[model samples]
Target: MDQLHHQSERYGTDYSLAICDVDNFKKYNDIYGHPAGDSALQAVADSLASHGRESDGIYRFGGEEFIFLLPGQTPSGAETRLVRALEAVRNLGIAHSGNPSGTLTLSAGLSAYLPGHRVSSERLLKEADMALYSAKAAGRNRLEVAPEVRHIVRS
Candidate 1:
């Protein structure tokens, strides 16, 4: 994250960070068992990695959460990619009785670092995390962008 921030600072390019969570993961685990939950997580991870751009960094952020670093991407561009990733995971057809859709789904929150913004990487992550919570609250399987970041980018 530090490296990406530095590069963005030096090159004047924008980048976006996203935090995603598997919807109803706990219920899925409770209903299916740990081994099945682990496999489901793996499938979701693979789907996210495959659907993202090669330049994007995808990492398991512990448990059912994952993080994405999209280099040279704006907030909207990152949303486009993340939406695709969400659909890819849904299309995996992993049964999740706990989920309303009866299939695995993902929800994500995104924040972007624009040039001359003077924002710290930590703040960026916090914003994304907050947005992630908002996504979950708004009903999972959707993407939410940090309102502050979006406002800045628009201006």
Candidate 2:
């Protein structure tokens, strides 16, 4: 919160945020047990951290969801980087403690700024949430840019 005020010039409100949630993770855990679920989440989080920008911050937004902040990036650029990172997640092929190998996938939502629009931090989160819902609706393991920002260049 302090950062938003103190670093206003350094960190413009222009940043975009993308939130990714693991699809069907609850079912996987309930069926496979918590240990496997923990392993999967850890593996995914590690991969995301490695693939993300040095300046971009990632957070565990509760169960099965992680948010990646794309500072100074346009919506399209955010999507592009995200698509690559997400693809990598799809291919991670981590072995489930119960399934032996090759388990789990993610669904992500992307929110970006429009040409003339500015959004508060809370609004930004909501937009990302909507996009995430759309992604899940569209089909799991896919990316959906916010409707308003879809035209923004991907990557």
Each model's lDDT comes to: 0.91, 0.75
Could you tally the backbone clashes for each prediction? 0, 2
Top TM-score prediction, candidate number: 1
User: For residues 1-155, what per-residue lDDT tens digits would candidate 1 score against the true structure?
Assistant: 88998998888888999999999999999999999999999888888888877899999999999999999998888989999999999999999899999999999999989854558889999999999999999999999999988787778
The TM-score that candidate 2 achieves is 0.84
RMSD of 2: 3.6
| 28-141 per-residue lDDT for model 2 (tens digits) | 798878898888889899988888789888888899899988777778678788888787787897643333234577778887654454555666678788999998887777
Candidate 2 clash pair list: 76-153, 80-155
What TM-score against the true fold does each predicted structure earn? 0.95, 0.84
Q: What residue runs in model 2 are displaced by over 4 Å at the alpha carbon?
A: 1-13, 95-102, 151-155
